[model samples]
Target chain A: MSFLELRGITRDWDGQGGVRDISLSLQRGDFLSILGPSGCGKSTLLRLIAGLEQPQHGTVVIDGRDVTALPPAQRNLSMVFQSYALFPHLNVAENVMFGLKVRRVAARERDRRLSDALKMTGLDGLERRKPAELSGGQRQRVALARAAVAEKPLCLMDEPLSNLDAKLRHSVRRDIRALARNLGLTVVYVTHDQGEAMSLSDTVALMNKGQVEQVGPPSTLYNQPATIFAAQFIGEPPMALVEGPLLGLREGLTVGLRPELIQLSPPEQAHLTARVLDCEFLGSETLVSLDHPAGQGLAVVLPGHASQVPGDSVGVILPEQDRRIFDTHSGRIEKASQQNPAALNRQNTAPRDGQTAPEATEPSFDLNRTTS
Target chain B: MAGPRAIQGPAMTDPLKLERRRRAIHGWLLLSPALAMLTVFALYPSVATFWTSLWSRGTRRNPSEFIGLENYRALLEDPTFWKVVWNNLLYAGVTIPASIAIALIMALWANSRIPARSFIRTAYFTPTVLPMIAAGNLWLFFYTPSFGILNKIGALFGAPSVNWLGQPDTALWAICIVTIWKEAGFFMVFYLAALQTIPPDLKEAAEIEGASRWTYLRRIVLPLLMPTTLFIFVNAMINSVKLIDHLFILTKGGPSDSSKLILYYIWENAFAYFDRPAAAAMTIFVLIVLGLLAAFQFLVLERRTHYQ
Candidate 1:
């Protein structure tokens, strides 16, 4: 059995989207991230597991015990809120020791755990300072220390580092990962930033419109998205989708191509001809926006910098193996044979060495000719 | 260059100095009306009262004479004065905490998501808008010996009807209950605002920390409400002395001066007995007590309470 399990959790608000029939199971020490845009019910899912909100139809089992009807205090889980939620009245040490004090732990044990937590979160000497006196990063560390001192088997963090600057968020993200690993705690972190989820979580549950679109390792979600939304939502520039004779396919059949998969090639040696519209120089690589006959604005990520200027004519090559075909009706992936039956049937009569047929070389129907 | 430097240093500051002076004069000009009113009505009367306390009351047969400390000595020796002081102490000691506790309970109830919350909140705050004299007269019907609601309920329980306002033992207690009922709802508004200001996340945090409801209230909610409590405490203290409107309606400090507060006694000495000197002496005493309380709150309690 999984250490923690949420079976068919569902909650709905009047106008706001809430989690709908979300079921997830996690083993001990698994770092799971619920990633989605704002108001996509990621926080609601965490609150359901934390027992802060009651699910209309589901059971939450922690350690093989049903805790659905229990209050948050009985759930034996700690949460680091997005606002840090540190008590303004209490100093750092007091805030860290709050959970222990609530549990009526012995003074000596509380002190030992408080000191250890403060030291672990790098807030040792700042124990005497109040939360208002601390910087945003320091307040975040105090919140972490409070949760760490609780020493619960599970921890929930709701965008805990979103309040910090980019530099501080990077450092705190590393610290959170390290702390979760060192403590052997199962963590369910919620964030909208995909990079944080991809880098920090062992498993990413990408949610869309109150439901889990796909849940897998970050690499799997990026590479083999289960749905069109997943494919479009995961990547930075997102996958470019083309339909209607693009990739030599019939209508109602679409093909998804990652920006990095398409290459700039000579017109005689390319699949389709296009003109460069814009080039965005992003430090390491340039994202070149091209105006293709298949779609008006298709993008390609080129390694290093692209010297292409606007309105420059170029040829675009989409390799056969890199093409992901989907059915436009259901927005689901389809086999190559199912997507383009004619192409598959023609391949049988063509050479077995995977060479392009001579008949396919001619631009039979000009893509740009029909458009402009 | 030297000549220009000598000329420019004062010249640079000249307009700025003139501007500051103009602003200060403008500020004082705007403030003169309020200052004049305060001097005439408050400061001058206070000094004149102190001056009046040194003279003995004069009748039509004799001229008023300076008695120096005799009025104060007489005040100290009066057993009624001592009783009034003790009664006021009991009134404050009982009303302050009882009203605060009730106000907090009202605030919590009003803030919760209980059914009929708006109606309940309106009912709780209804007493605050009523005039104190009206409330006093209303409670007077409830304290009547035989037919009052309280005694009628007592009779329903097979208990004998007791005179609530006519007896010395129960009179002060009755007044205290009235004061608590009158003040709790007024103070509830403050507590409600303070409670609303406390983030809901803190309650959730406490719950996840495994704190019981009582522990959450005592530790998190109460500590965070200390500043509000301190503010209400000062107001309640002042009201304890000044709130004698009820005594006039119910019992009128009767039954051998049982429910007589310090302010009521001062009013009686000044108006009923025509003893201005004794009244001035008592007013000065009240001022000293209030001043001490204010100092205690600012110096001791304010430091302990967290503002934000």
Candidate 2:
């Protein structure tokens, strides 16, 4: 059985809905990243699981028992906020001991756990320092240490690394993932950063609007996005969306292709002819923005030294079997296939991802990206 | 523009000459009105008061003759002057702390998420805006011996209707209560401003750490509001010393004159007894005492700042 389960969880207020019937379960040692855009209700879902929020209609089950009506204090779950939410007045040691103190744990055990948590988070030497005296990375570590010392089985972090600089974010992201893994902790981590979710999560629940678009391993979601929203939301530079007639479906459909799968080569019989609109050269990969005047704009990632110019016309080899198609009207996944026939074929591909299709549009993305 | 620039290149470049010209015109513009007001209201009267303090109390037309330090010596000997000074000190000592405590409580309650908080804040602060004389008059309804509501309520409790304002024992207390009622709310506004400046994030963090409201207030909120508290303390102290406007209506230094403050005594000597030299001497003494109070407050506050 899953360690944590949310059943029929519907939270809404004042004619507006938050997470609509969010039913998901987590395994014991699994790190599930809930990826979504800003208002996709990922944080709300986390809050519901943390018992900080009560669902208007649903049950939250933890370790086989219903904890739906439990208050945050009784839930025994630990949460780390994006702001870190460190107690500014308390030094590192006191902050780490807060939960144990509240729970009335033995003083000696409290001290032991606080020291252990601090050592685990690399914050042992800085136990005497207040939150304001520490750098952003150190403050986050203190928050992590505080949560760790709570010694809860379930750990929920809401965009914890969103505040750190790029270099620090990457390094700390790995440390946190490793720490959670080593503890064999059931972690429900929320982030809009696809990179963070991809690198850290055992299973990524791609959400849009207020429902999960797809829940699978990172590679599965990347290779076979259950919905067009998931395909657009969970990748670097995003998947190139092109509006075209489906050859097999014999209808107007929106075509999607991953930038990694699009190859930069001269025109062949099977290739799509497009002109290079722009090119961004990172150290290892070059993102070439290809303009298909007949189709939609596409981005193709090639080798760093591809030597492509803006005006140069190039042929993109979008493998037929690798291409994804969605209904233009519904924005739902019509087909996840390598071969999408030309506009003269079938009308639409059925929505098939082995799980339920997203109810409405569950939106999620990195908050820092939008807020920045 | 070209022609003017060509003519004034070397001329405009001389900053010293330009500065002198600007200062000559601007100096008069800035100082003229202030200098005029000071000469008429402050400077001339101060000189006259200094001269008068060295003389006897006499007619303004004849002017008092020199009696240097005699008025000062008389002030030193007068038992009533010493009593008034003591009363002033006692009034300040009692009122300052009481008003500050009440203000702090009011500010905390007003800042919290209590029911009818807006109404409670307005009701508490309403007395502050009322004219002190009017407030004093309103309190008279309760201070009256027999017909007052306080006595009527006391009678219900099986206590006799006792004279309140007419007695030396209770008159100071009566006056102090009225003063606190009027001043507590005014001080609370300062505290409210201070409380608002303590960041909200700190409170939220404390709450997440499982700190109850009390713990959060004691450890985080109170420490952060120290600077604000100090600021309000100094202002409240100054107000307590200077504010005796309500006394004239409420107590008027009644019965054995136990409620008499220094300012009222100064009023009695200056206007009622027509002793201008004595009044001037008393005024100088009052200024000295106020200066010392300000100095002591600053010294205490400076040390507090260093420790914090």
lDDT of 1 at B255: 91
Residue ranges of candidate 1 with Cα displaced over 4 Å = A13-16, A266-278, A290-297, A305-308, A311-314, A339-372, B1-13, B26-37, B58-67
Best by TM-score: 1
- Superposed Cα RMSD, model 1: 6.6
Interface RMSD, one decimal, each candidate: 0.8, 3.9
The sequence of per-residue lDDT tens digits that candidate 2 reaches over residues B1-308 is 12222334356558765666566557666778998999999889877887889999777588668999999999999999999888878888888889888998989989989999889889989998998778888899888888898999998998898888889988888888887888899889888887886656555445555667787777666766676667777776667666567678877787777898888888888888988899899988877777787788778765554122
- Model 2 C-alpha lDDT per residue in residues A193-273, reported as the tens digit of each score: 999999999999988778777899999999877666777787887777655442343244566789988776545432555
Best by lDDT: 1
For residue B43, what is the lDDT in candidate 2?
85
How displaced is residue A17 in candidate 1, in Å? 2.9
Every candidate's DockQ is 0.66, 0.23
Top model number, DockQ: 1
Q: Count residue pairs with overlapping backbones in model 1.
A: 0
